[model samples]
Target: MSGEPLKKAQESAAESPRALRDLIGYHLKRASAWDLHNANAALEAAGVRTVPMSVLLTITEKPGISSAEICRILRMQRANIVPVLAELEARGLFLREADPDDNRIQRLFPTAKGREEAQRMLGLISAHEERMLAGLTMAERDELRRMLAIIWREDGEG
Candidate 1:
């Protein structure tokens, strides 16, 4: 959507009970919901969703990254990340190797096709971010990202 449409949509959300705005968490939740819905739709064509794409990109960024490392980087639990790992492996997007020195540990590395898919997904995600952030100027976008990083860091999430 264009800046005008995004602005209108945000205004519509803001029209909700003003009392809700008293808490910053409400705005975060609202923005998160909006991103979740739109990002899911944006990534649907690649048979991927936001969380999985995030995992894929993370793995792509760091080859030989272990599942434990992924859990730490993404702040995911072993149980929650298990299924996602299984799905990605089953899809041939990545492969796991036993640590040479520690066979009990498994490391993740993206396959050739996985790299190809990552590029495509990155493109899609870039376009999606462009549309979603259209309402904000470049400076506002940078500040928004910095503020969000601080929020994550405060919770030891980043």
Candidate 2:
């Protein structure tokens, strides 16, 4: 085959759907892993080592948010959140109480220490998020967020 035809064939192969999806997936996964690593490092630098991402997310959002609410928002299984909640409770970072409105429900409330730690962790997380989103313009970032939300909705996650 001539060099020109070989080049054309290679170009077409690169544009194939499977190849495109693989490329997209590779970059997406890499970015996600890097973000997670950086976030963990940031949290550690802020003197937090044992807190999981879910716990941080929950605590940062509301001081006395319920565990059931966390599970629902995070789409996490109840069993998966239980051990983390137990650990956080044991550390005296938070307390769980039976909801007065519904005895079957458990409510989560951070202790004073937990609130302080959560504030520090939130600062670290904000810094990390700023770094992660540094390059994109505000409009571009908004668009990207919108697109991701669409994907999540399609997957029944939003």
Best by TM-score: 1
TM-score computed on alpha carbons, candidate 1: 0.90
How accurate locally, in lDDT, is each candidate?
0.87, 0.72
After superposition, candidate 2 runs with Cα above 4 Å error: 1-23, 47-51, 154-158
For candidate 1, lDDT tens digit of each residue in 1-61? 4467777876876888878866778889988998889888999889998878888998899
Please give, for residues 36-100, the per-residue lDDT of candidate 2 as tens digits: 88888888875554245458558656766787778777777878888887777777778777888
Best by lDDT: 1
lDDT of 1 at 116: 88
